[model samples]
Target: MADGERLASVTWLFGQPERDSVTEQAASPSQPTTADAPRGRHEPPTRAERASRAGEFQRINNVSMHALARRGMSVAEMRDYLIGREFDQHEADEECDRLLGVGLLDDFALAETLIRTLRQRKGLGRSGVTAELRRRRLENDAIEAALEDLDDDELARAIDLAERRAPQLRSLDTETATRRLSGFLMRKGYSSGVVRAAVDRALSRSGESSGPVFR
Candidate 1:
């Protein structure tokens, strides 16, 4: 009877493992007892999984390219677009090449589109459009080509721009107005010679002489 009682005591003490023992085994470095494995959180994705994600990335870039073209993107404009979206250089370059290859992007076409848009909407001249195209990183050949198409349109717009802004130009004294008009036209992308000619023409049309004569 004493031995059976001792056996019962042994069973109660050690036969079932303690929860603390299980926890210590789990906390042990060599073996992980639970699927949760509590140490390393958010492990990096495997190579195959990364490859799958890269494919999805390319697909999304393709869609974004078409969407940008729909909004009238030139080569430089597209570069700016990708930069704005925080695309890495490699991805942005690849997308640029793909779009250019597929005819969805062209620098000359973009320059022409800008010229037309600015002429109708903003009343800008050839020099103004040329400056803008250059700012957009268009090739010299492309800029020249776009400017060729604006010969008549640009001259007319220049005249209108000068006429419309004449009051402000004339508000200054004649010498001041000449200087101010020159600066203004220069800011609008006109050459110094062109600005001088335009200023002379405007003054003559207003019944003022070629020399500095106050109104």
Candidate 2:
């Protein structure tokens, strides 16, 4: 009887704990654990898979080449173009550097070419050429450099334009003709002084007076 009583005690204490341990071991994988928990909400992105830079560079280069094929672009223009296409800024910058090195993107050269076109084809004055270069995103230094080689016949060009336009003003009085000619030259990007001189010279040529007498 004592042995059975002792056996009952042992079953109540040790046996219960042993069965609990085995149940825990069997149930462990099914239950959630610290290691099995989902990733934190604030995990850093460095561990995430990233696209290859080389691949990105090649794609950007392709896009840049296609854009350049259509028209010559300044460095800033190409940069804006790449950014508009959703390329990364740093990557776009590197590609621009590459293009500049290869002579594909040249702001100064572009400025020079545009200056000639603006002068010869469009009949723009120095101010007009400078404004156009600015619109094209050429640097200030580049604009200055391009303007340095500009043709020295600005006054002549302005006079030519004014003379051509003066005949239309023959019906108007001297004051009216002078005012109209001055306005036209100013809009063409000539300075106030240049406009005055051009108006006088042009009016003289159109027989408005014997010659410009500083008026």
Candidate 3:
């Protein structure tokens, strides 16, 4: 085709005010585009809904506290238990504080009771009692206070444990008996010095010459 014919064809194809039409559409405020459209309103929770949620949290706290009370749980133990049960940390802490405030949870009392029970019934030494208290999440101060009562009688406690265990090992030879007794006391968390002395007294009473020496 001739250049003038081609130019006329092009002009006819795109010569209309397409840009002006788009500009007019964009400038018109009557029509709202996606960006200009109003957003859906969000409703806040009602007072009743908030109260229901709070009631649910209280119920959970009450159930947990009651169960722990039945078992005589310490504050830390209850908190850990509640957390393990999927309770919120802040909620668990609040519940534990309530229990503590009412004396339903007492770490010091728990520690003292456990110390006595471990020593008298379980044949646990001071170290053993401390470890048990720590495992129960008792504070160090509570543990120390409880242990203070054991300071004067810890040796006697170890001796009683050794004497009780000595008879069972009577059939073994002296070396074997001493070795077994020492190991038993050590596993019970006794200090090496205490174990040695207790083993000696126990073995002597049980007709053994002396306790086995351990490095």
Candidate 4:
């Protein structure tokens, strides 16, 4: 009977350890795993994040304004400048529209200003002015609208340009002078008719196209 009691006590002690181990494991807090993480979460921007974005946009706006002050920029140009400066595209577009609403960025106005500059300062005629406006990336509607303001003065401008350049051709033969003068005026964006008329009038005035005098 005493041997039987001893064996039973030893078994009970061994079983207590296993029971304790199981109880401790069950009572311990579980560590969160990836499977327990929040699914499809999207946190809203904090105040600091919002402030940082505002400051960034303000800097972009200032840069655009300074660029405009330095020289005229079309709406497309301002957007490109902002994007090139690493601003977000959507934000850049928003700022551009804001400026446009305030009349600070006007494609039509820019086109008009460019037209005046090319015509008066650079002596470019209608086609040349249009080409330059397109090069500046103005909208097509703005380009057409701005061009409407131009007076019917292409012929006069062409004549003036030809007269200025005709004196240089006095040394060349009449045929050579005519050819060169025509090319020059054509390159200046004058039409063929305008070029022909200007070349003829210029040569006649300079006596370069005179008939042979009788001996």
TM-score for each of the candidates: 0.58, 0.68, 0.68, 0.73
Query: Which runs in model 2 stand beyond 4 Å of their true positions?
Result: 1-55, 208-215
Residue 75, model 4: Cα distance from true site in angstroms: 1.1
lDDT of 1 by residue, 76-194 (tens): 66776776778777777778887889887888888888888877777665677777788878778888988887766444555566655666655467777767766776677666666
lDDT of 3 by residue, 102-192 (tens): 8888889988888778877888877788889998888888888888777566678788889878878867888888899899998888899
Write out the backbone clash pairs for model 2: none
lDDT of 2 at 177: 81
1-215 per-residue lDDT for model 2 (tens digits)? 69999999978997898899999887888778888897788874442324565566678889999999998898999999999999889988999999999999999889988987887887788998888899999888988888888878888999888887887776787898889889888888888888888888787765436433222
- How does residue 209 of candidate 1 score in lDDT? 49
lDDT against the true structure, each candidate: 0.72, 0.84, 0.81, 0.83
What is the lDDT, from 0 to 100, of the residue 145 in candidate 4? 98
Q: In model 1, what is the error at residue 184, expressed in angstroms?
A: 1.8
Between candidates 2 and 4, which one is better according to TM-score? 4
Each candidate's root-mean-square deviation in Å?
9.3, 6.7, 10.1, 6.3
Flag regions of model 4 displaced more than 4 Å. 1-50, 208-215
Which scores greater on TM-score, model 3 or model 4?
4
TM-score of 4: 0.73
Please state the error at residue 52 of candidate 4 in Å. 1.6
Clashing residue pairs found in predicted model 1: none
lDDT accuracy of residue 73 in candidate 4:
90
lDDT (C-alpha) at residue 16 in model 2: 90
Q: Tens digit of lDDT per residue, candidate 4, span 1-215?
A: 69999999999989998999899886776845677776455877779989998998789878888898899898888899989988889989999999999999999888878878888877787888888888889999999999999888888888888788877766787888889989987887778998898878777776345432111
**Candidate 4 local Cα displacement, residue 5, angstroms:** 26
